[model samples]
Target: MTAILTFFTTLACIVTLLPFSRHPHWAIRGMDFPRLQFAIFIAVLLIANFVFLNKQSQFTWVVISITALCLAWQLWWILPYTRLWPHEVKETKESSPDKQISIMTANVLTPNRKVDKLIQLVQIHKPDVLVTLESDQWWEDQLKVVEVDMPHSIKCPLDNLYGMHVFSRLPLSNQEIAYLVEKEVPSIHTTLTLDSGDKVRMHFMHPAPPSPTENPQSAERDAELIIVAKSVAKSNQPIIVTGDLNDVAWSATTRLFRKISGLLDPRVGRGMLNTFHADFPFLRWPLDHLFHSQHFTLNSIKRLPPIGSDHFALLTKLTLSPTVGADQTGLESNTSDHNWAKEITENQSISVNDVPQVDNSK
Candidate 1:
C-alpha cells in the first residue's frame, strides 16, 4: 500500500513541477493543461496519507508535506479561473444595443458531418462575427448558406484540418489571411465596423498544439502568441483575439500572452469554460479563448452545446464601453515581459510586420 501511494505521489509531483521549466518540449509544456487533474490526484493521495500512513515516521510526514505543497501550487494557478476570484474583465451594468457585439468561435473538427446542427446554432445565436476552426472546403461550402446575411467575411479552407473561416454581419475592412508561424497554418486579421461606427481590430487564430505528432516543441505556438501580443500592444483601437489557442487559461504561455497584449479574459472570475475534448468530460480544458482590450466589458461568456465536434462552441458578448478602463486595471507588460517576448521571437522567422495589420480602411 505504501509502495503504490509513493509511486503516484512521486509521479504527481513531477507533473506538478514540470511546467515551471522553461523547456519547450511537449512533455513539459503539455503538463500545463492538466493542472486541475494533477491537483485532484494530489488531494486524494494527501487524504489517504493522513488516514492510513503512520504519522510517527518522519518519512510519512515528508510525503504529506510534499503532496500538500504540490496541491497548493496547482490550485494557485487554477483558482483564479473560478468564480471565487475577482473579475479581471468587468461586467457591463447596462449595455447599449448599438455598442454591443456578440462573437461565436468553434473548432468544428473538419471531419464532423453535422453541418445542420452547427448551422442551427448560428441561426439561433446570430452573432455579429463567427469564426470557425478546423473547417475544410466542404464545411465552408455548407456554411455558405448564411453568407447572404454575413456578406463581409474571409475563408481559408484546406484539407489539412488547419482551415479557418470568419463570417461577419458587420462591415469588415482591411481583411487579411496570414500564415504567422508554419507556412500552411493560417490566421485571419480584420477590422470590423460596428453599428455605432466604432472600428475594432479582430484576430482569429488556431495555433498548432505542442504534441508528439503535431509540434514537437512549444516554440512555434508560443512565438505566434507573443508576436500577436506585440502587435496588439501597438494598436490604438479596441482589440479582440479569439480562437482555439490550444493552451489552458492558467498556463504560463496564456498569462504571458495576456500581459504582453494588455488584453483581458472573461473567464478570469468565471468558471473554466472548458471546450476541448467535448466527447470526454473527464479530460477537458478551456482551449478556445477570447481576449479583448479594456475598451470592452463582458456582457456574457458561455459554452454552447456540442455540434458533432470534439470542442464545444463559445459565445461571448461585449459592450464597447471605453470608460471601463478607468475602473479596470489591465495586465501591463513590464520590461521583463517585453524581453521574454523578444527572446522567444529571436529564433523564429517573425517580425513586427509578420503580424498582419487590420487598420480601419477598405
Candidate 2:
C-alpha cells in the first residue's frame, strides 16, 4: 500500500510540474487543466501518508517534501481566482436596460439534442445575445425558435465538432466566419449595436482542445488566441470575447491572452463557476467563459442549470460604461509575455494550405 501511494504521489508531482516546460504536447499541456482536483488529491495524500506511514524514514520525508511542493505550485496558480485575491473586474455601480448587454454562452455538446432545455432557459433568461458551441446542423435547426426574436445572427453550422452559431436581438454588422488555425474549425467575429446605440466588437470562438484525440498539441489553440489577442490589442473599440476556450482561467496561455488583449474576466475573485462536464460532479471545471474589455462593468453573472449537455451555460450582464475603467485595472502584458506570445504564434502560424490537418475520421 505504501509503495502504491508513493507512486501516486510522484506521478501527481510530475503532472503538476510538467506545465512549466512550455511544451504543447497533449499530455504536457493537459496538466494545466486539473490543478484544483490535484490540489485536493495532494491534501488527501498528505493526510494518508501521516496516518498510514508508521516510520519517519528518509523515503517518507522525501515523499512529504514532493507533495508539499506540488501543493504549493497548484495553489499558486489557483489562488488568484479565489476570494482571497482582489477582483480584476469591478461590479457595475448602476445598470440600465439601454446601457446593459446580456449574453448567454453554451456548449450544447452537439450530440446531446436537449434543445427544449436550452430553449426554456433562453425563455427565462431572455439574454440580448446567445452563443452556442459544438453546434451542428441539428443544433442549428433546434435553435431556430430563438431566431424569431433574435433576428440577427451568424451561423456556421458544420458536422465537425467545431461548429458555432450566434443569435442576437441587437443589430449585427461586419459579420465574418474565420477558420483561423484549422480549416474545419470556424470562429465568429462581428460588431453588435446595443439599444443605446453603442457598438461592441465581439469574437466568439471554440478552439479545439489539447487532447490525444484532437489536435494533440496546444500550439494551434494558443496561436489562434494570440492572433485574436493581437487584433484586440490594436482595436480601440469595446470588445467582448466569449466561448468554450478549452483552456482554463488560470493557465499561463490564458493569462498572456488576457494581458495582450486587456480583457478582464468576471470570474476572478468571484468564483470558479465550473461549467464543463455537467454530468459529472467530481470532474468538472470552468471551460465556458465570458471576457470583456474595460469599457464594461459586470452587472451579474450566472451559471445556468444543466441542459443535458457536457457544459452548463454562462449568462453575464454588463453595462457599457467607460467611466468604470478608472476604478478598474486589467493585467498588463510584460516583455516575457510578449516574447512567449510571439514564440507560440510563430510556431503555429502555418498557412491554411500548409497546415497539417488532423484526421477527423475515427
Structure candidate 2, residue pairs in collision: none
Clashes of 2: 0
What TM-score number comes out for model 1?
0.97
lDDT of 1 at 264: 89
The sequence of per-residue lDDT tens digits that candidate 2 reaches over residues 50-148 is 777655688887887788888898999898878888888888887878989999999998888779999999999999999999999999998989999
**Tens-digit lDDT track for model 1 on 254-346?**
999999888889899899999988999989989999999889999999999999999999999999999865467656778888888898888
Model 2 scores a TM of 0.93
Please, what is the whole-model Cα lDDT of each candidate in the order they appear?
A: 0.91, 0.86
TM-score of each: 0.97, 0.93
Which residue pairs show collisions in model 1?
A: none
As a whole number from 0 to 100, the lDDT of residue 66 in candidate 2 is 83
